[model samples]
Target: MTAVPQERRIVTAIPGPKSQELQARRLSTVAGGVGSVLPVFTARAGGGIIEDIDGNRMIDFGSGIAVTSVGASAEAVVRRASAQLADFTHTCFMVTPYEGYVEVCEALAELTPGDHAKKSALFNSGAEAVENAVKIARSYTKRQAVVVFDHGYHGRTNLTMALTSKNMPYKQGFGPFAPEVYRVPVAYGYRWPTGAENCGPEAAAQAIDQISKQIGAENVAAIIIEPVLGEGGFIEPAKGFLPAIVKFANDNGIVFVADEIQSGFCRTGQWFACEDEGIVPDLITTAKGIAGGLPLAAVTGRAEMMDSVHGGGLGGTYGGNPVACAGALGSIETMKELDLNAAAKKIESIMKTRLTAMQEKYDIIGDIRGRGAMIAIELVKDPVSKTPFPEAAGALAKACHAEGVLVLTCGTYGNVLRFLPPIVIGEDLLNEGLDVIEAAFAGI
Candidate 1:
């Protein structure tokens, strides 16, 4: 499935005959809690299109929730991982370590921001990496309180669930969560209470004030946030906001951790979204796009901070599985060779133009924001009210699906249509997906 048939083709209605059959089976076996945005069952996915079991092709805009920047089955990744699979599957690195894992650490040291000496620890998922990061920070700083921002999404693990801000699906009834996690305001420009101009300084000051007054910086071990808030509506923290927060963390000896799980790996026009602001965090957590489509995550940070955790304190039975390490190396190679950072920038250029036009045409599109290919349009009920229109977002997503274009809805308010196309997609295919989006809006 390295290369899909390429064009978007609709052989049947969305969730076509085979997909409908699969859905019936899925309902029987799958938990009701688990959900899919679209019911179309994927047969194969590569390039810009996902081929469904019933021979339908849909443009891929979700990128498997920003995990497959190199395509679901990139040629290089498949080649490298296949070779590794043939040699061996898993050898529990703790028992007998392998070169691929070390090589990955070396790559991380070189590629991650901050030229300072750095080291990395691998994990099996973003939540695991994030939880480990908190552990490392607490170990190094000897503090208990962890500060996170409003609208921030960490993960679903208990500790991460406590760190995450959303309530409905991610948090509901999942309480008895970890204690000492504090929430602060984020500098979201579009919906800023005091307007965009004041969002940066005002919001940063408010957060700092909150930490100082309520949380008390002395009790905080770390301040964790997504460089560009993902799942919480792709909110890019206003300019000067992150740096201000970083400075506060530095002054208070609080570890500034950038959770780049969804925004790293060239998904945000740069190697990592934090790089866009030149903010060098004490630690960074990454996962979604790191291993092509394999489950792998890592916490990379200052050598001193990571080393403070001590041996046996930061490993898992399956962490850094050799095959996943191979895939990560392959994904990194693909990113470097393809210059996917530049590709992400190209995606932004194309997406911004069309999305801006869509914004002009539709009053419902209140704000169009994001960097690189990780862009989104905020849906509103009307231009004057700026009232979130989750219904419109849902309607548009359903419309796009009917037209053979795969789109995703996100946002704290659930009124945002986020787009995350693979960096490897052809420009024509990208625009075709946009065309479907435009038509979806038009129909609405």
Candidate 2:
């Protein structure tokens, strides 16, 4: 049912002549800070393939940084959004209420973890949802300090920049951030100083100690974390880490916020990554894959915490646009019909098998971690020293791009190669993409 062919076919060089021209124009008009991992200009995308204007068909391993889980231009998503477009585009959900907006919130209430009576507020992006979750937590607990983890990426907004730990690109020169934000260590098993086995409890104890000694638990309004850290390199906290943190937050009066913006909506083989540990957050922030590529986000949480905010205190002009809500409904329908959660787990099984083989063959691969479709490999200069090999990551990605496979890189050290293939991708196309990566690794 997808219009684009699910195959990788290189007609010209990666950036072909047309893409080069577009890149030149883009540099002239776009801001300097904006960056592109692969510069091939896309003409159409569906299933698992991105067709460039130059007639090159490329396998989409990045999924537009995990935004197109249901695939770009899914039939149901396009159909529903088009029907909504025919009805109306925008009336500002705040000024004129609509059923679509309310329906999305209803879906979030049902889908998000937890059986307690829940409520949801819509937003236009993940950053807005996260910021609002912080506000709601503060209003509920009447506390000012917030705790975030090292290597976590919230967003580019000022406060989210504060929540984000990386410095070079996201937080460089953008200082004077919001006040009272605190950072703590996460349970990164591979890089844990002591050892991988001891990471779970040790990191949790260290984090709690820092909050108690440095900032005082009662003063903290919220403790936010990505169940599976995305931009900070697909790092899933070790076992016992999340439960311990959740217990600590409950013990203290801090609202626990799970930033599921990247790892939510079946991206991690589960409905949400927090469900892997059966951890229920007080407030859950979601976006990215919510509306089949439309700009829609949400903050769903306990009824009491959400209602704590004053009326009209949480809304935006374009939040929960009617068309986006339609897209979200259609997306959810597609996910259910296709059983993308099962597909994501299948992807994990295949990728782990292939990547594990590649790791055994190559010494540069230091670690293989992540769940379901959101998987990554950390490159290192040496296995024993474990020094990050960011250059190798960059090289491997570039090679994959040249061969018509779109790959992405991340990590605080810039040494992680992440693959987020569309959950609906064909098995043949998925294997072909991995083949490209294996070939690239061999060459590098």
Candidate 3:
């Protein structure tokens, strides 16, 4: 494989000459509600570097929101997708099945967390995969209620909005959310009601007890959770919390789902985050990095459960598009060949070392946490008090962007700076990104 670019080149101010002109045009052509993380417009990206229209190169720390795991514009992904395009683009799997679709499903069945007799279905996005998973669960269990955790973000669809916990953006103005969805507490140790150190199995048990009493476990169709909470600050569940929830779901005959949308595909040093705890979920929903930036999502689960839905009940016009499946196959192959799990671990080592040093130097960094390359630093006004420093997070991210590094901020309170470098990122480029972060924090 070719090496990643080693340096970041900043030729102009961040929304450089060309990008500023495009940004103004975009404001008129696109909806004002649409947002941009960094003002720079990309001309090209490969490995860990994103080259902008102004000829400036920035180190990419946010891998397209944890997609593009093999690196942006991966050669293998581009080659396979191009080859598949030469043959055909889409026949719609629902209309005419193809080998690429079957091949992608076969790979998913073999690689997902569980070893049970598994089957897979592809969808066009993470939201669709989530919605379909609920449909299948409700059909198989013959139950109406589906339970999702607080701080968990499923998608933007009406059904998924009901499943999601955030109020703004996704839920705002999208009222009258789909019925039969219930919300429960997630194992967020940082802000857990019981206190961080004490919020393990007991907190989870409390939440489960509430669900069993309030929603009645018998009426629940499925209990869905992110093995590591994405978008909601990358909160990893406390040690015993996940297994406890799984036990509860099993005892109550409720389907257990793991939302690995952002944490799967070796982003968390494992194929799936649930593997960290050795807990096999009944249904695994994945997207983001699965296809190396193509819009492909999947729900892989027990054969019988997946077969519960009627044939025509689970498909989209663009579900499992041949080109996307081809990309997925190539991305998975690249992941295995490159040992991206090991790469994620290496990223974790670098991040932990650098972030720990930052924590010692800057009191604004309240907490440093996450698994593997999927790490984050929570900013706070008072480190001892743990009060979120939203302004500081925003300022720090802006500074990093100005200095030619791209970083993303996420959290319920919007005070967390997340690092989602591609697993294939080079050591020199990764360190360069870290240096920019250090410089940004130093100014604060």
Candidate 4:
């Protein structure tokens, strides 16, 4: 493995000769449905930089889609996972239990929002955690309908695709989706039909009203939403919207599930995004940043609700794999020692300052939203019309990449430039990356 210096050094063009050759091979072998944001093949990534095969280094604004909050190959995670790998790769927890899996669950219970008694079940990905959360919610509540908000993304499975609000590459031609899934209004401050000031109360009321009249609250199993929407742009639900919905769920006996996969584990300046707002969810699904880039996710919730599932119903063969569990434990230890929450807040401050300055200059930046290190700028044709400018977003991302800064663009309308820098990224490197973005904006 390369000991990549945590600095951007574009010695060659981004997808330099070596990567260009591999790109051609990838197109031939990899499926078309699976897409990549950056074309260059990564040699090593850590801290704030991704070193490509050709030795070109680029600042990592996307933390492997927010999976590596403690930095992609943090010493703790690698050390622990390596030890576990050498000991025994997998006995399968269902077949033979391991301490690491239980330990990961313990961390989840202690760390996830709500002071109530909580239990957790681990899985291989965010989607599995989400899908299992649905199963548990339905089992406990004996309800059929699952409600998700507009501009929210749950996962890619048939069921999650239904819960997810976006269409395009995610849901298009993938249905007939799982039934009993209802879509409601999200308090998207930027493009809310009702306007930003009224988005919170109005959207919450409409969502609650729709459930009451159409789905009937009694029929609802869960209301799953991302605290700060990811993939459908980084749309944070306006203040009061989440609390209102949680209240509705409480009144109706519907499970309040927060999909915190992208916003959990100190990525949002708190252990979890919901904690900042004091919005306690009955169930929370986590992945992404949970294990310092390992493929592990968990559904942590109230003890009784999680216990509702039959003994063998909630797990998969690789659920809480010993090595992943080790990684997660190590990841958690790193988070505590590093106080990555404070780092996340600092990232937010830097981003807020730079992006706010950019907004002052650029008419294309319609709105800036998100919390902690998970920030985004919604590009629009102009602030007046607020029409999505997906093309401009693409151009800006391209320019940043060429300048040795890896910026990611996402959104419902493909108009959001989301930055998920590692919490450990240094201030100097961070500012340098921002300079690239600012220059990109100036050129575009």
For model 3, which pairs clash? Answer: none
Higher-ranked by lDDT: 1 or 3: 1
True-vs-predicted CA distance for residue 391, candidate 1, Å? 0.4
lDDT tens digits, residue span 197-316, model 4: 898999899889988999899999999999999998998888898899999999989999999999998988999998866999999999999999989999999999999988899898
User: lDDT value for candidate 3?
Assistant: 0.90
Candidate 3 per-residue lDDT, tens place, 1-444, comes to: 454455799999888989999998898899888788987888888788888999899998999999988988888899999999999999999898999989999999999987789999999899999999999999999999999888899999889998888787778997898888888877888777677777877778888988988999999999999999987888888888999999999999999999999999999999999999898999999999999999999999999999999879989899999999999998999999999999999999999999999899888888889988899999999877888888998999999999998999988889999999888899999998999899988897
Work out the TM-score per prediction.
0.99, 0.99, 0.98, 0.98
lDDT (CA) for every model shown? 0.93, 0.95, 0.90, 0.91
* Candidate 4 Cα errors over 4 Å, as ranges: none
Instruction: Give the Å error, residue 118, model 3.
Output: 0.5
lDDT of candidate 2 over 1-444, digit per residue (tens)? 449977789999889999999999999999988888878899999999999999999999988888899999999999999999999999998898999999999999999999999999999999999999999999999999999999999999999999999998988898999999999999999999999999999999999999999999989999999999999999999999999999999999999999999999999999999999999999999999999899999999999999999999999999999999999999999999999999999999999999999999999999999998999999999999999999999999999999988999999999999999889999999999999899998897
Those runs of model 1 whose alpha carbons end farther than 4 Å from true positions after fitting are none
Model 1: per-residue Cα lDDT over 116-217, one tens digit each: 999999999999999999999999999999999999999999999999999988999978999999999999999898799899999999999999999899
- Following a full C-alpha superposition, what root-mean-square deviation does model 4 have from the true structure? 1.0
TM-score of 2: 0.99
